[model samples]
Target: MFARRRPCRRPSPDLRCRPSGRATFAAFAVAVTLLPSLAQAQCGGSFSGFVRGLKDEALAAGYGAATVNSFFNGAAQDPKVLKADRAQGVFQKPFVEFSRRLISNDRIQRGARKSQELNKVFHRIETTYGIDRGVLLAFWAFETDYGAFQGDFNTRNALLTLAHDCRRPDLFRPQVFSALELYARGGFDPARTTGAWAGEIGMVQMLPGDILENGVDADGDGKVSLKTSAPDALMSAAKMLSHLGWQPNQPWLQEVTIPADLDLEETGLLHRKSVADWQADGVRAKSGSFALRKGPAALILPQGHKGPAFIAYPNFDVYFEWNQSFTYVLTAAYFATRLEGASVYDAGRPDAGLSGGEMKQLQKKLQARGHDVGKVDGILGAKTRLAVQKEQARLGLPADAWPTPALLKRL
Candidate 1:
C-alpha cells in the first residue's frame, strides 16, 4: 500500500503518492503552434511533442529561452506518476477505519506539541487569517506526516507526465506554467525539487499553482519556503484556506448525537439545515454546546446512521475546496478536533458495507439504471454515494448515503 495524498479543487495543489512503474511512451507529430488552452486537447499524441509544445508556450509567455530551456532540460515523462494517479483505492476505506488508522496517538501528541512549540506562529495565523492552527496541523500530519515523508517523485516530470496524459490534462497543464513561474522567482529547482506524486510541494503538499498564488514569507526570510520552513508552510496553508472562504472562528465539523427517530433522508451535504432547525430535530452535541455555531450545518452520516455522526458547518464546506475525498476531509477535520482537545469519536457499529468488487458491481448497476456515478472504480465517491442514496430512498430504506450489502443485493 502507498501513503495517501490530498486532491484539491480546480488545478490547485494537493498531495499524494503511489507505486512507481514504467509505461511505453507514445509518439506523435510535433506541432508547436497552438496556445496552452488549445494544446491541452492534444496531450495524448506524444510526450516529447507535448513537452516541446509546453516549452514553446512558455517562450511565448515572455520567458527567456535559457530559463525555459533549463526548466525542461532534464524533464522527461514519468509513467510512475500516471500509475499513482489511477491507484487511489486507499480512499475507498470507510471513515471509521480510515480515521482510526490516520489519527494515531503519536500524531495527536506531535500535533499538540507542535501547537505549543509554534504558539506564536499559530497565534499569528489565527489572528491574521482567522484559520485554526489545528486545521492546518491536521493537514500537515496527513499530507506528509508533518513533512516526514513528502514523496520523492521528480516534480518536473510528474507535472509534465500528468499534463501529457489524456485523463486530466486541463487540470495539470496550468500547473506546468505555474511551476515555471516559481522557478523564475528562484524558489523551485526543476531537477532537484521533489514532492508528492501529484507534484505538490512542501509540508502541506501544495501544488505549484497554489504555491505561486498563496505561498507566504511568514518567516520574513523574503522567500516563501514551504518545504523546509514550518512557519512558512503553516502560514501559507492558512492563507490558502482563508482564500478558499474559511469562515473566521466559525465551527467546521462537530461531533453530535441525533435522536434515533430522526429522518435519515435529510442527511448528506445536499440537505443543509440551520443549527436551530437541527436542534429542534433533536440533534444535540455529543459534547460541548450548540451555541458555538449558529449558522447552517449538514448532518453528515458518513458511514450510515449506525456510525459516527457529525454536523458540518459552512467552514466545513470549505474543506472540499482543499481536498475532494469525503473520507479524507472528514478524517482531517476530526483530527483537528482531536488536536483541539476533543475526545475520540464513538464509532458506532455500522452495518457491513459492500466490498470493493461488490461496490464496482453496484456502480455498474447504478450506471445501467441511468444515474451518473462517474467511474466504476470501486471507490464510493460523492456521485456514487448520491446514487446509493437515491436508490435507497426508492427502495424504502434509510437514504443516509451509505451503501450497504443489502443495497447492493437489491440492485
Candidate 2:
C-alpha cells in the first residue's frame, strides 16, 4: 500500500514512462550498438601505446619528448608500405632500352632548361661536392619527374608500418626510430613529412637515415628540407654520391659492342678489366673512342646474349648503392647522359618479359631437373640464366640459355 501511494504522488515525467530496470536495459542496448567503434578506439590506443614505448626508447637515444610526441601522436601505421620492400621485376630490355622510356625528349628538354636556370647553384654544388651538375640534374629528373610527383603518402606512418612488418624489420625499424629522432629535433614537421610508400622522401626519395646523416642546408637558411628546396635535395644527393665513392672524372657507364662468337660462359661474373684488355677482347666503345683509359670496367649483359651491353665502371657500382636495381641505376646514368645532350641508346634487343606465373613455372621446371635456380622467385638473373643454360645443355638444345614458352613446353 505504501509503494502504491508513493508512485501515485511522485510520478514525474522523467520516471513515468519506464521503470529503473527498463531504463538501465535501454542504456545497455545503446552501449552494445556502439561496441564496434569502442573496440576500434581500443585498438588504436594499443598502437599508440606501442608508439609511446618507441618514443621512450628514442628519448633514451637522446631525443626530446616533445619532438617524439609531435611525430608519433597521430601517426597511423600504413599497410601498403611493405609493397615497396619486395624485390622488383626483371625487365626484358637492357638498361639502355629501359632508359629510353625514362629519359624521353620532353624530359630532356625540361632537364636542359632546369640545368640552365640553376647553373649558378649547380656550379656551387659541383665545386663543393665534386659531383657533376649534369649528374645531379639527371637524378632530379628521374627520381621525382622534376618534383612533379614526389608521392603524397605520410612518411612516418609508412616507416612505422614497414618497421613493424617483419619482412624487413632490421632495415626499416632503425629507420623508423631515426625518423622519430629527426622529427623530435624539429628537423621536419609531421604534417610536412611525406614521401614514397617505402618511406623514401623528397625529390631524391632518400630514406630518413640518409636525411639524418647526409642532409645539408644548401640554401644556407640553416635547415634541410628536401620537399621544397632543390639545392638542398640535389646537394644532399650529391653528398651521398660522394660518400658512396663516386670517382671524379670517371665515366659511369659506356655502351660497348660485344665480340661475335665469344664464349659467354668464359666471361664469368663480369670481372673488371682494363680498357686495353677489353679492346684486346674485341669490346669497343660505340663511338669508336677508347676514352675510359684510367679505371677497370665490367661487362653487363642485362638481356642475356641478344641485347646491348655496357662496360660499367666503379662509379656505376656506386649508382647501385643508391638504388639496388640494375635497371634503376642504368636509367640514372642514361638520364644523366641525356641531360648532357648525349644520344639515346640504340640497343637492338627483343622483348621477352615473362609473366610472374610463367617465370615461377620456368623456375620450377628448372628446379625439377636439379639446377640451383634459387627460390623460384620469378626474376631472371645470372643464377636463373645459368640454370636455364645447364638445362638446355642437358636437353641437347641450342644452349643460348634464354627462357621461352617453347622451352617450358619441352620441360
Candidate 3:
C-alpha cells in the first residue's frame, strides 16, 4: 500500500523544475557551431559514441575544454543505474503502508528529538523563510535517513547512464550538464561526488542542476555544501520551496472526512475548490475544525475514496513537484504534521496497490487496449490514472483511479 506525505511550497521560476534543455541551450548552440570540428577529433567508435556525444554536449553547453574532460571521466551508461531506474519500489506500494514506512513511531520520535537539537537553528530559518521546521527535518530523514545514508552512486556516471538511456534523455541530459556546472562553479569533486541513483546528491538528495541553480550558503560559509552542511541543505530546500510557490502561512494538506453521499468522483486535486467550498459541499475536518484560511485548497484521494481524504492547498503542487507520487507527498506532509504534534493518520481502508511487475502488466494491458499511459515503467502517474478511470467507467467499476489486482485481471 502507499501513503501520502508532503513537500509543500513553491520555488522561484528558476527554482522550479529545471528548464527544458534550456539550462545548457547556450552551450548547445556553441557545440552545434563547432559540431563538425568537434566530431572530427576521432572518438573511438561503438560504445564510445554515446560518451563522445555527451562530451560534445558538455562542451557545446559552454563548459571549457578542461571542464568536459574532468567531468565525464569517460562515463558510459551503467547497467546497475539503468536497472535501478526501471524499478522503483516506493511507487508500487499502497498508501497506508507507504506512509507507515516513511513516518513510523521510531521516525516520529527521531524527528521530535531532532527538533529539540536543532530547534534554535530551524526557528531562525523558519523566521527568515517561513517554511516549516518539521517539513525540513522530514525531508532530511526521508532523503538520507537523518544523514545516515546519502546514496553512493557516482553522480556523473549515474547521470551519464540515464542521459544515454532512451527512456528520459530530455530529463537526464539537462541534469548531466547541470552536474558539470556544479563541478565547474559549485565546488563538487567528481572523484567524491556520489548520491541517489538518479544522481541526486547532498543530505536532502537534490539534483545537481537544482543545487547549482538554487543552492544557498545558509551557514554563511561562503560555499554551499549540501552533503556536509545541514544549514546549507535546509536553507537551499527553503529557497526551492519558496520558488515553487509555498505559501508561508498555509498548511499544505489537511485530514478531512468527505461525505459518503457527496459525489466521490469529484474528489481529487484536479477537481479542486477552496477549503471553504469543500466545506460547503460537506467536507469536515477529520481531527478538528479546518483552519487553513490562509490558502485555497483541493481534495486529494491518495488511496481513492475508500481511504482517508484531505484538502490539498496550493502548496500541494510543490509536493507533487518534489516527488510525483501522491503517496510519497502525502507521507511527507503527514510526517511534517507528526513533528508538529499531530497523531498518526487514521486511514480509512486496507487498500493495497499492485506490485511493480503487476503494475507493468497492467500498463501493458492498458496500452494494448489503446490507452495513453505514457511508458510502462510501473510508476502510477496522471496518464495511467486517467486511463484507469476510463477503463473502470467502461467496466462498471468505480472510477477511483486506484489500481488493484482485480482491475488488472479484468483488463
User: What TM-score would every model get versus the actual structure?
Assistant: 0.91, 0.78, 0.84
User: Candidate 1: which stretches are off by over 4 Å?
Assistant: 1-41, 291-293
Clash numbers, per candidate:
4, 1, 35
Per-model lDDT:
0.82, 0.65, 0.72
Question: All predictions: root-mean-square deviation over Cα?
Answer: 6.4, 18.4, 5.3
TM-score computed on alpha carbons, candidate 1: 0.91
Query: How would you encode candidate 1's per-residue C-alpha lDDT over 107-193 as one tens digit per residue?
Result: 998998899999999999999988888999999999988889988999888989987888777667767877876777678899999
lDDT (tens digit, per residue) of candidate 2 on 1-411: 000000111111111111132122123223323554311212123556667656655554444566566777778876565554453443434355566667677988888888888788888877876677768877778778888888877888877776566555445555665575465456756676777777778887787767766788989998898988888898888887887678865677777777776555534234567878888888788765865886777776665557666677778877756764456666777667656655656566634645667878999888887778766767665567778767766776545456667678788
For TM-score, candidate 1 versus 2, the one ahead is 1
Candidate 1: residue 248 lDDT (0-100): 88
Q: lDDT for model 2, please.
A: 0.65
Q: What's the true lDDT of residue 42 in model 2?
A: 20
Worst 10 residues of 3 by lDDT: 1-10
lDDT of 3 by residue, 1-411 (tens): 111112212111122323343344344534544566532322223546878776766665656777778777656556888788766677667778777867777877888887888777788778877888888888888888887788888888887777667665555655665676666664677777888888788888887766766788878879998889887888888877776677785677778787766665566666666677788888898887786754467777776777867777777777766777766777888788778866666688835768888989999999999999987878777778778777877897767778788899888
Kindly report which residue stretches of model 3 are placed more than 4 angstroms away from their true locations once superposed: 1-47, 74-76, 294-296, 350-358, 368-370, 393-396, 404-411
